[model samples]
Target: GAGVSQSPRYKVAKRGQDVALRCDPISGHVSLFWYQQALGQGPEFLTYFQNEAQLDKSGLPSDRFFAERPEGSVSTLKIQRTQQEDSAVYLCASSLALGGEMAGYTFGSGTRLTVV
Candidate 1:
C-alpha cells in the first residue's frame, strides 16, 4: 500500500466481545507501531515491531491486549472481553527505519471501537 491502512473504521462491541483491528503498512517499511487513544487524550503507544520481530509491547494495558506482525507487512491488534473503558481509537503507523525524526511514521486513520 502507499500508506498505512486500517479496517473496520468503526465498531460497536457488546461488553465482553472480542475485537480485532487490522493494519497494512506501506510496502518495505521496517518499523510498525500500534497506539490507543481515548477521547480528548493523545495516542498512547501500545506496541512496536521491526520486521517480523516484536521489539516492544510494554504499553499494552493488560494480558487481554495483543498485537502481532506475522509476516511483517501487516499487523493485527486484538482485545479480549471488551469493556466500556476499552472504547477508543486504535492507530497504526509504519516507518522505514527506527527513531530518527518524529515525523517519519505514517499513521493510519484508526479504528474507532465503542464497547457498550
Candidate 2:
C-alpha cells in the first residue's frame, strides 16, 4: 500500500502569491489530515477529513488557507497570498480515523514552503 506523499518537497514563493500543494494518501484509507510545522516545532493540526467530508478546519491560520479531499482520497491544500508567517513545512497525513491522534496518523515527508 502506498503511504502518504506530497509534491515539490519544497516551495519558494513571494509574499502574495498563491501556492497549492498536493497529497496522495494510502489507497482505501478513509481519513486525511493536513498540518503545518514551523522550524524546530512539532506539527500542528490544520484540518481533517473523513472520506470527502471535512470534519475540522479550525487550525487553518487564515481564510487564505483552503483544503479539500473531493474523492476521499487525493487532497490539496491551497494557500492564497502566501505570507512570510505562512512559511512552514506543510505536512499531509492519513489514518483510520479523521481526527488528530497521538499516534494514528502516518505523515508525509512534507512540503517545506519558504516565503519571501
Q: Highest TM-score: which candidate?
A: 1
Tens digits of per-residue lDDT, candidate 2, 6-84, equal 9979999999999999999888778888999999999998998999999999999899999999988999999999989
lDDT of 1 at 75: 96
Per-model clash counts, in order, read: 0, 0
lDDT of each: 0.93, 0.90
Whole-model alpha-carbon lDDT for candidate 2: 0.90
Predict model 1's lDDT versus the native: 0.93
Off by over 4 Å in 1: 100-103
TM-score of each: 0.96, 0.92
Per-residue lDDT tens digits for candidate 1, residues 24-81, read 9999888999999999999999999999999999999999998989998899999999
The runs of at least 3 residues in candidate 2 whose Cα sits more than 4 Å from the true structure, single-residue gaps closed, are 97-103
In candidate 2, how many clashes are counted? 0
Candidate 2 residue 98 Cα shift, in angstroms, is: 5.9
